[model samples]
Target: MEFAKPLPNYLVTRYHGWKATSYQENKGWYRRLATEGQRPRAMVISCCDSRVHVTSIFGADQGEFFIHRNIANLVPPYQPDGDHHGTSATVEYAVTALQVSHLIVLGHSQCGGVQGCIDMCKGHAPQLEEKTSFVGRWMDILKPKYQLVQDIEDEEQQARQLERQSVVASLENLMTFPFVDEKVRDGSLSLHGLWTDIGEGGLECYDPKLELFTKV
Candidate 1:
């Protein structure tokens, strides 16, 4: 393929720094990981937001978590049709192949994707509603949850509520996968939902019994 542009110099510089410092300092660890392969304990599904760093939040090391990012941190319901499904494929590999013990859906406040979903559902984003809009089609997974927050009179509050709802929706959707369901039933896997406050740096974990998110 023809090149649109060369790699950015800043990113190249950062890569060089990491190669010299992090890679050199952890050469043995990196070598072991490369030789033994990854045995990650958890799979975290989070938004593509640049602010959300899964490893930084958990203080995790390399190969500790199998992370996947997508808009709104939403998981679509299982559809067995033979077609492209990135999130589903990752979940399958994690559950069946990797046998990850925990699967966490991480949502965050001030999520642009969640806001976009709210806008698209409210008829404010015509561009997203178009058939060709991949983001629009992907976000349709969270559209139903919008009804849960529509009655909130405060717009910002409603958007935040919907952001948390994205986590709940994803957790529910995760159970729809047969492999995930089987593993959970067999006591081999667990599911979790979490939401983060970007500005305050607060983390909340969802309690299924109370159907609420409490600070962690």
Candidate 2:
């Protein structure tokens, strides 16, 4: 990391504030966490959107939830090709190593990644269709989902539908992992899908029985 610019001043200041408050309020808890290691009960897969705050929305404390974030909160199908796979690795560690009981795919409204998938599928984003563009290639996983919503007449509604589909797609992909499938079948693990409305601050959980997202 030579010749890189200095870290931003605001981030440095925020770190100091967090350190002082965290140590002052929960020094014992922090020490215990460091000594015992983490044992989060749930794992949350969410979009890498600034507006989608998993901890804040769930009121979770430190060491409670194992969180993983990607462009659109997608979990690609299990591919043990011995290549680089960040999301898959995270899921493997969470389920096999951590033994987390719940795995949740959390989608959100106004997701730029989802919108990019829509644009790429519609031939509107050429850069994303290029092989060199990492985002475009990563979003390819969600391209098939666009077809499910393409028939929707309203542009906003279509985008929203794709966002929800991202969650469902991730859930389906999670089941492709043999360990995940085994645990889920034996009742040791459960899968969940969720969507959030950024503007309305509303949360919805997907009901597999009805195949719809209802407010939580």
Candidate 3:
């Protein structure tokens, strides 16, 4: 298509460099992965935020995790009459097709998507309230949880609370899928909620028993 653009020079150069070094060093492994196909043990649903590096956080190697990224790392409640459900489709593939044992919803502090939801909820960003705004509609999935933090007098604290809530909310929504529900109930699949502090490099996992996020 005439509309398609070429890769930027820097990215093209980086690709060539990686091919010559990393890819060559792991040529045998890459060949095996290409031949055998992937069998990632875990599926990680995380935000599209550029700073949130899902692999770097865990020091994971190639094909270790099946990763899906979306704004706020959300998983919408199951809707069978699907028209266009990207997140839902990925979850279906990960759970039913890939048979991934663990599904983790990863959220982060200072998340722009979470902050956008906060702004939209507080009526500070009128443009987001319009139906034509895709981000606004996506943020609606987390709108209800805003009520949990709105009364907080501190803005940073409020946003931080909602960030964690996003992870918890997505984990709940993941269970809404029948396949996920059945597997989780049978102890075949597990779900996790995690939040990361970007600047401090701290990670916290939600303790379902304590109903709070404890430092990792």
Candidate 4:
């Protein structure tokens, strides 16, 4: 039952290199973090895309941010049906357990997940329409928001709009959780939406009041 495969050699080599250099340099910091446990100030929900490095973008260190990555960075509405809910569990732990002051939904340009949602909604992706497609079901969370950007004539513009909308959609879903809502109402937690440009290195923050993303 245990025979399968081993980790790739490249990963093992990199781990050894880190253990020799970065790990040794920050050994004390890592030990302290291990003993004290994580008390991250903020929790960032972002896409699983490898290019979206939240830590590098924010220049953060270990134990500074509680980060969760998933396809499209989506948060489904609260449903206490006694089912497995990974994102919901993460949010609950971050807000109610860790008491993180900030909860950020980070979106980015050229997001494949958002583009898949657009394609599925436009009836262009038949494979995604299949009920057996896990990705299709996951992208369903953002399917409704496609209507907002459907009118844009340019494909690039429409994709960009939907990418930003994904962040807003996640933020909206986060509030549906009772614990998250309670903390927000009590001024103990704050929600934020951010969209970044991978090629241009541009960052924008959403303003709930202005109803738009502004450059930071």
Candidate 2, residue 19: how far the Cα is off, in Å? 1.7
Q: Cα miss at 56, model 3 (Å)?
A: 0.6
What are the lDDT scores of the predictions, listed in order?
A: 0.95, 0.95, 0.95, 0.95
Off by over 4 Å in 3: none
The reply for model 2, stretches above 4 Å from the true place, is none
TM-score of each: 0.98, 0.97, 0.98, 0.98
- Supply the global lDDT for candidate 1: 0.95
In the predicted model 4, the residue pairs found to clash are none
Model 2's alpha-carbon lDDT is: 0.95
Candidate 4: lDDT over CA atoms?
Answer: 0.95
* Backbone N/Cα/C clashes per model: 0, 0, 0, 0
lDDT of 4 at 166: 97
Per-residue accuracy of model 2 over 1-216 as CA lDDT, tens digit each: 788998799999998998899777998998999999999999999999999999999999999999999999999999999999999999999999999999999999999999999999888999888899999999988888888999999999999999999999999999999999999999999999999999999999999999999999
Write the residue-wise lDDT of candidate 4 on 1-216 in tens digits. 588789899999999999999999999999999999999999999999999999999999999999999998899999989999999999989998899999999999999999999999889999998999999999999999998999999999999999999999999999899999999999999999999999999999999999899999
How many residue pairs in model 1 have overlapping backbones?
0
C-alpha RMSD for every candidate? 0.9, 0.9, 0.7, 0.9
Instruction: Write down the TM-score for model 1.
Output: 0.98
